[model samples]
Target: MEIAVCRAADVALLDECIGSPGAVSSHARRFARQGEGGGTYLVAWIDGRPVGHAEVIWDGCAAPEVRAALPGCPELNGLGVWPPELRSRGIGGALIRRAEELAREYGRTVLGLGVAADNPRAADLYARLGYRRLTDYVDRWSYEDRDGVIRECVDPCTFLTKELPSGSLDVKRT
Candidate 1:
């Protein structure tokens, strides 16, 4: 398997892998802005097919209130492996390892993210990868679409962070 930086073309493929239009659009924007310091996006490919994807973000100085309440750290924004079929085959772990490598390369000493508190599997995966829960918090936000219907969604998010070993990645911290 090969882990490589994602290009704009990979956005569609990634959306297919995750099976969500919202996730696809969000990630598409992230990939497009990777070159501008939004963060890095990568995909794990097996036999020329993408099997997993990861995203690492550094919010620079615009740290949102949600992120500021805890601590300012490299944020592992999104990670998704293709559904049921390839899960538990270690693809997810391999993708995470790549994310950690990139995080280190970006010169970030610590990484953090908000995960759904109800998802034990995801929480366990992060824990196994050295991430520790820093706070229990719920993020609430509302949005309106073209149809003018306002939808409110609350995510039970937990903030987790992991410190990188010194010199683990080649980049220098900013």
Candidate 2:
């Protein structure tokens, strides 16, 4: 598979990939187009078709809460892979490795990410990549439907931080 930065044209495809039932959330359009403080985004193409993707953001500031929990620099957020089929194929790890590369380019010494607590697979993947658990918090929000009826949802967010080396961090299934 070939991996490359996602372009605006890939939004629809990425949306399709990330919006599948098993995913925690689907916000592909935001990453596909990018905004100020854009971090890094990549897509894995298999047989010339987009099959997997990862999106991330860097604000140059580690969240105060995350910093209080661990020693690290630079806030990283929104890293995810698309398509349930690509879960264990190393696509997510590669995307993170690329993000670390960008972090170093920005003169950062540490990188961090937030994963939902329910996602043990992602937590294990990050651990194997040398990311140590820094802190855990709950993300609670409300969503409104067409009628303005709001629904509440709560999810545990685990923040993991890692010091980057010169090479890609190796990740393994746990």
The true-structure Cα RMSD of candidate 1 reads 4.4
Report the number of the highest-lDDT candidate. Answer: 1
Residue-wise lDDT of candidate 1 within 38-109, one digit each (tens)? Answer: 788878787777777777777622235546655557676667777668877777777777777777766777
Worst 10 residues of 1 by lDDT: 18-27
Q: lDDT of each prediction vs. the true structure? A: 0.71, 0.64
lDDT by residue (tens digit), candidate 2, 1-174: 666777767666766655532223234544633544455666667776676665555553344566577544555555555557667887777777766776776677788777787888888988899998777866665555445566677777877788877554353311
In candidate 1, list every pair of residues with a backbone clash. none
lDDT at residue 136 of model 2 (Cα atoms): 80
TM-score of candidate 1 to 2 decimals: 0.79
Name the runs in model 2 displaced over 4 angstroms: 20-29, 60-64, 67-72, 141-152, 166-174
Q: Backbone clashes in each candidate structure, one number apiece?
A: 0, 0
Error of 1 at 96 (Å): 1.8
| Top-TM-score structure, candidate number | 1
